[model samples]
Target: MAEEGQVIACHDLRVWHGQIRKGYESNKLIVVYLTAPWCVPCKFMAPVVDELAKKFTNVMFLKVDVDVKQLKYVPIDFGVDCGVESMPTFVFLKNDVVLDKLVGADKVKLEQLTERHATIVVYFTASWYGPCKFMAPVVDELAKKFTNVVFVKVDVDELKSKAVDFGVDSMPTFIFLKGGDVVVKLVGADDKVKLERLTETHATL
Candidate 1:
C-alpha cells in the first residue's frame, strides 16, 4: 500500500478512473501501472514507480492491482480487450485515452515511452540465449541513440504467453510498432550496421 500523495491502490481504480476522466476533461496526462500481487516483477517495480511518481509531479501515477476483485473491469476500461496478459504492464494515457503499453519491467523503456510519445518497440529475447545476450547492449545503445524509440526487452523464457501472443518463434526477435501496427520485424542478433539500415528503411530514423 502507498502513503498519502504516493501510489494509488488497486481498490481505488474506479475512483482514479473517474478522477483521470475529470483530469482528461482538462487535457491532462495520466500514467497507470497495471500489476498483479503474485507477479514478482511487479513487486520489484513498486518502489521504482513510487520514486518516479515523486519525481514527476505533473503526471499522475495510478496503480491498478489486477488481482483486486473490483478492478476486473480495468482491461475493458483501458481498451485492453485482448486481456491482461502480463504483469507490471504500464499503460500511458492522455485525456483518458490509452497511448501505449509496456509489458515488462524495463525502467528505461518506460521512461522513453513517456518521453517520446511514440509507438512501443517490444523485443522478444531470453536470458540464457547467446544471441539475446549479444544483442542486449546493441539494443540499449540504440535506445540511447534513438531517444524517440521506446525499446522493451521481453524475456521469452519468462513470458512465454506474451511471446506466443506476439507470435514470436525465434530468439532476439524485434517487433517495431507504430500506433499498434507492426512497422518492422527482425529476427536474431542484428548488428549495428543492420539495425541502422532497418531503422532508416522502416522507421525512417
Candidate 2:
C-alpha cells in the first residue's frame, strides 16, 4: 500500500503487479517513473516527481529502478513492449493500458501531462445491460474526442463492490471526478449532447 500524496517504490515484481491492479480496479491513473540508480538525469528529476506526486493526490506514482534484476522485464505484463531507450521515462497508464509516454527528464512537460490526465470519468456499466451496451460506443467516441480526459469503463458485475462504493444503482452511470473528488454524476443513458456537456464542464475544472 502507498501513503497519500507519496510515490510507491516497486522493488519486487509482485508489488508492481499489485499496484497496477489496484490502480486499474479503482480507475486511477498510474504514472510509472522508469529510472536507474546511476542515471544522473533521473537523480535530478527525482524531487520533481515527488513534488508532482504531492500536488496530484489522485495520481499513483510508481518508481521502478530498471537496473533491478527483479523488474528487468518492466511493463512486459502491459502487453505492449515499452522500449525505454532512456532513463527518466514517464509512462501513463489506465486500466493496464498505456495512455502516453514521455522520454527524458522534462519537469514542465511532466507537470502539464499530469494535470491534463488528472481529470477522469468513471463509467459504470454491465455487459448484459441494454442501456450500458447502447452507451458504450457513445462513451468510446467521447473518450476519443476528449483526449485530455481519461475515461475508465468499470463493469458492475465484475466490480460490484466498487460500484456500491460509488452508489451506482443503475446502468450507464457516468461519474466525473477531478483529482479524486466527484464533481458531477449522471445516471441513465443520456444522449451524447448532455453527457458531453457534463464531461466538458468537469473536465476543464
Q: Which ten residues in a row are the worst by lDDT in model 2?
A: 76-85
lDDT of 1 by residue, 107-135 (tens): 88876665555435688988999888888
Q: Name the runs in model 1 displaced over 4 angstroms.
A: 1-5, 79-85, 118-205
- Indicate which candidate wins on TM-score: 2
Best by lDDT: 2
Clashes of each: 0, 0
TM-score of each: 0.50, 0.57
- With a 3 Å backbone cut-off (N, CA, C), the pairs that clash in candidate 2 are none
